[model samples]
Target: MTSENLIKYTQLFINNEFVDSVNKKTFPTLNPASGQKIADVAEAEKEDVNKAVDAAKAAFSRNSEWRKLDASARGRLINKLADLLERDITQLAKLETLDNGKPVGDSEFDIQCSIDTLRYYAGYSDKIHGNTIPADGDCISLTRKEPVGVVGQIIPWNYPIMMLAWKWGPALAAGCTMVLKPAEQTPLTALAVAALAREAGFPKGVINVVPGFGPTAGVPLALHNDVNKIAFTGSTEVGKQIMAYSGQSNLKRVSLELGGKSPLVIFNDANLDEAVEIAHGAIFNNHGQNCCAGSRTFVQSGIYDAFVKKAVEKATNRKVGDPFGDGVQQGPQIDKASLDKILRLVESGKREGAKLETGGAQIGNNGYFVQPTVFSNVTDDMTIAKEEIFGPVQCILKFETLGEVIERANNTQYGLASGIITKDINTALVFAQSVQAGSVWVNCYDYITPQTPFGGYKMSGIGREMGAESLEGYLETKTISIKMPGKL
Candidate 1:
């Protein structure tokens, strides 16, 4: 099916059925590439959240098909979903590109990674068993790891399908039902994935996708008393709000993967060519919408000038325009608000006395295409260095020694991820160990895989996603004890 056909599944997915909301309200989702409306998705509100929650709660009830099914059966179902996702890679990539305004190449990569994540969790499904405990008496003691029941998942727009997989993979593996809310800006691929999950023979209410605004759908889902947990990947501000909502509601478990202004440090001994390319990709990937993007580029004072010049050249050469265009490396920001914010930050960088090396302006008056911006001679106090621009803007700061760079890198409130480019193993190992971020890269940047645990420290997030640790967020541990007969 073409992306157009794929986008027709824009209705709210509830109880394995694509249906209109209770109020029949809808919102138009736009294509960031052309500033055009692709489709009017069914807008879910409080009532719709209640209905979806009811479905998920019922599916999570003991004796329900989803709960009573064998562990391996759940694994098989998830694997089948992965198979279908792989089969429709092309069309899914297209949907992602159209809705998200990311390069088609990046979309394809995300689809593949999403498949890998799902399959990874599928292998983990039957393996999630508790253990027997030894007691001081003849009594038998054991523990069972069980699903945390119904969950509410709120994912961001920067990565529509990939974030869906990140949220769904572990939740499904743990045998939990969920009501997910896709970002209002990018909901097409999410709705399409919901259809695939249904085709994978998941029981009704096993998964629900509600497309709507944050205040209406997202807030209600977070505050729902029946929701056993809320797994959210978005802004730290919004994550804090959800945490507050969880406390106000039922004190439900909450796992958040929030924002970051991650750093990428380069030592003097680092290969200049590799360092330049790695630094470029670190910040420019996904148009710099990544939470753990290496926004702060700290270079050793000896090579700072050379690195800045080459970094400017790299940013200037980066291709920006149509997402589907051949050789295009950059695309529009998600919407007007994002574009405006990036431009605003770029202006602040210039206003606050940081030298603009190259490409600080928007491409045209059409779609939200931003120029790949670079700033040199940036001090730690500069706006570009202090705040997360979250754009294709690299702020190059000079550092004298390892201790200084590590201290500067750890100064930010966000500790999602960081990187260091150096040839010396001691430097790399020491920097990695010293960084407060969740994931650290030595030679490369953004080296994320399905099997690795990904999350943040401090304000970045509350829990990990992907890997074995993610399963803990969706599971609850229960202990059972048996008394032996004294006569025996």
Candidate 2:
């Protein structure tokens, strides 16, 4: 399953089958570690988008088998899909690594997590409930949850397979037909998963994938009047554009898990080993491309110098090489634009007076690789501390008190996730309660589960992604009242 042995062609998935793009246009998905195209994916045009949307709409409308099926039946179908995914994890992981330049180990974990997520949501399918209300008269009142209809889901390139599972799981469990659009950089795994889904007995047109550029296909999907909802996981800037399109076209319900500049605060009383381990896991995991990654780290002033030194040493020791290697811990960014963006942000940090601790330069000549970078003496106002670099770069800032660190951590345009490393229960409780971020980790960072609800606050995006609450996003609440013959 290595890139050398991997195949190069993948067709679009529409109407529960592999189909060619209407225009027969194709785009090469490059391996960021080697700067070489590993696969060619169908480039979905506007007509392809229309076909996918039409398929999803038909599946969602009345008389369609997908919408006619009960939640339990949907859950069984998705669980079958999860089983198929588990059987092919190895091959799928290799494809993801080759297509996205993430290490094979990380890709395996991501694919496994994707399976768990689908199963988790599938188990919750029948758990979606409605409530009855008491009335003053001899009347009945109740509320029910109904599917939001056709959903246009867009997944990011960093963790394509996992994010797709995150969106598709709940959307499908809620009985909403979906039109998925994976990032153009890496679409092989998504297409492969769609094939497995078809084999799992999902009805035709229940799930469709259209792969194309953002402007042409993505924008059209977001602007389609028939699309009942838009769910996106990407940058904040692009999230804004999608929101605008949703507003202008259909005013559809939109759920976004956008960009994050999450903070990891280490108190003086924290466990040094645990702090260091969690700090590394927070930013270095997935090459720091995670939206909920604790990218902005703040340490107590008393332990600032020692913490920065140890963190830099640990970060610099990260293995950056071929993503296909088994022991490689870090790999290249997703593409050339991502690499250039990380480099430019590093330059901005240097120009703005942050001290480069270690590993700031680019690595290798053939790929879009960046050395694991760490910056010290980063104030809260610096660009490195404020903006998300989204590479394996850590910005270590110093803080004095718990109150001060909480305030500084909350002072950001993004509120996706934050972490606290401290042994004191009172301090951890206060910080967790006071932090504005959606998720707060106590001694761990970048921990995700299909049971825990994941999302953000303020500019970080809207709605929740996991847990029972996620089912709500795909459903609309309707109130029903019935009058009795006799008055109260």
Candidate 3:
């Protein structure tokens, strides 16, 4: 196929145009579905990162046309960008599919979500209000919400496009210039997004993208003194490192959406068919690479066997092949390293005495794919139950009562998202209120809207994204209190 025919792959986008890297270092982004090299992307070094940051800093400091534009003008620009995205949805979706190993249709849906997010945040820009404090004397006092200047946004490989929206939608609407570092594995869509923004008349240096490995580009961006705020979506380990760098370097404001071993609980009262389908989606969608994959399932023992049997049967029937191929439900891991980590976790589950019910081996020859493994009788202590596999692996554990299940689910170090499937309204309400997760899905999994705030609790993450609160995270609150000289 010609390069144009391939939906994914781009060189680089920096400062409102496609550009070449200064280092002349290039890396191949692979199609995970077939383990085939898709396209060569310019590898950005620390100097390149510095350049991007400097450009963003300059843009933010200049009070340029971008800043001078009124809130309505900013909103219009974002809406126009959204319109451009919708106009070329297919191309963007195809690029996401090829690079991220997700189905094209799903990629399109993600693009739609991105569009909605931008529009939502755009509407919020003018509405973000300052609070006027009632002063004791004849002084004017108010708090204003202003952008934190230059932002360094680093997105993870899984759901790269969506995560980018989560970071940039609010940051952009808040009038912060941003330097984006997309995960090396999935830079194609990000590059496309940068192009769209430029086409929509965003000023040069308002947004820049540099695709490179995390340790080099990501690290420097987080630690750069010029970067006033850092927003990241990735593992907790990396989140910690970002925090450490931010503390040591600039004391920058940091927002992270980290890893999760989110739990899905199905009570005996749940409609079996509905529960089973949502359960599969919770765990297996995106090949189970979801940060909130619902990896740990707590099913009521009254219907545990039936649930597990149906879950395995459905997963086994799922088509696992090339992501670009029609009807394929699952794709390969992002790379070999992720595949190996998943396999080791599966083995650890077996060693820990969890019953390996079905599917636990590499499936294909060319790509880093694993079978849709399911484990039953999983204890809370099992590695599969604790650590994030970031693959298509499901571990189901039985619980007798709500108390027991809730306890087991919250016993983890991470609390990103949790799901409950119960026909009883009271039960659903209880679980929703009591669960320690950031989001509790009832009767569904992976359902997200642009207006709702999403993030995590505890080690799962810090700060919120995807809602008006996200704008707050990108801004600084300052209180101006003027003392009254004559009244007191």
Candidate 4:
């Protein structure tokens, strides 16, 4: 189907129906590829958030149909949702590419990952049972895992569909109802997914999707008193705000997978070609609009010069243009604002005396496309080195020792992900163990799987997102004790 045909739903998805905003207001969503209007989606605000939350709260009630459903039934519904997503992968990927300006292939990859994530959590639905413990003094004790109830999940613009699955998977598995506020920039696919959820036989008020700006829709969802938990995946600044909003309102459980300026350490013993390719993809994938993009590349000085040369060649050869175009390795940086931020950091890198290896300019006049930028002889204190330059800019820094590089890698206040590209198992093991980040890749970078847990350390934010471990954030463990003499 064509892109126009895929623009089927632009309204807020609440209580299993698509409806206009309370005030009948709408906002235009732009296509970052051509700087043109895709469609005007329903702009959800405080009232919308309240409406969605009420629906979710009702769904979580003790006698609600959703809560009364069996765990295996929940799993069946989740699998059905995954099936729908997989069936409509092409349409959703095109929609995602049109809205978020990522390559269609990457969007397709995201949908597959989302399906995998959903299926993974679906299997966990029946498996998430309570454990009977050996209690003291003739008393039987056990722990029951119950849903947190009425969760508010705010996903980021980058990887919209993937983030939705990441949050919805576990929460649905645990039998929790939710109101999700998709990023205003890329809300169309989310609305589509919510439609599929209804088709998958989810009860009304079990899931809702509202599309609006952060202050209007996002803030209300996070601060809603009825929301038992708030899960956010975005900038560290906004993550802090979500935490504060939870505090100001109900002290709700907050799970944040925040920003990162992760480092990739390349030892001299590493394969030069492999290291170059991995590092290139690490920072440049998704046009570098990634939370765990390895922004800093700390190369051991022995092979640093050679790696820099090959890296410059790789960056120079990358094609940047329309995400829908063929042979395009890089796309525009989400929007004009993101493009401007990347340009600002690129300038900072130049002014700080780093060698501009290649590519540091805007590619076109219409879209928000940027050159695949590379810099060598970068220092730790440079703006490009320190900040999470979520763009196609690579900063290659030289280091002397493993000890020194490990310290340098952990120097940042943010530690979401880190990587080591060395053949030495000893070096890789030590680096993986010593890294402060949540997920440390040994030979690869940004190696995320549905089975593996992913999150950050320090200012990168709190809590995990994927795997069985993420189920904890969505559930509350309650201990039950009974006297043996009280048995019937």
Give the per-residue lDDT digits (tens) of candidate 4, residues 1-488: 13669898999988988999999999998898888888999999999999999999999999999999999999999999999999999999999999998989989999999999999999999999789998778888999999999999999999999999999999999999999999888998999999999999999999999999999899989889999999999999999999899989999999999999999999999889999999999999998899999999889999999999999999999888778889878878788889899999899989999999998899879889999999999998888889888899999999999899888899999999999998899988988899899999988998899999999999998999898999999999999998877556
Q: Which stretches of candidate 1 lie over 4 Å from their true place?
A: 1-3
lDDT of each: 0.93, 0.89, 0.86, 0.92
| Tens-place lDDT digits, model 2, residues 30-98 | 888888877678999889999999999988889989877888999999999999999989888888888
Question: Could you tell me the lDDT of residue 178 within candidate 1?
Answer: 95
Worst 10-residue lDDT window for candidate 3 reads 1-10
RMSD of each: 1.3, 1.5, 1.8, 1.3
TM-score of 4: 0.98
RMSD of 1: 1.3
Q: Write the per-residue lDDT of candidate 3 for residues 15-120, one digit (tens) a residue.
A: 7767778878899988877788888899987998888988888788756877788888888888988898899888788778878777777788888998898889
Order candidates by lDDT, high to low: 1, 4, 2, 3
Model 2's TM-score against the true structure:
0.97
Q: Which 10-residue window of candidate 2 scores lowest in summed lDDT?
A: 1-10
Q: Which residue pairs collide, candidate 2?
A: none
At residue 409, give the lDDT of candidate 2.
92
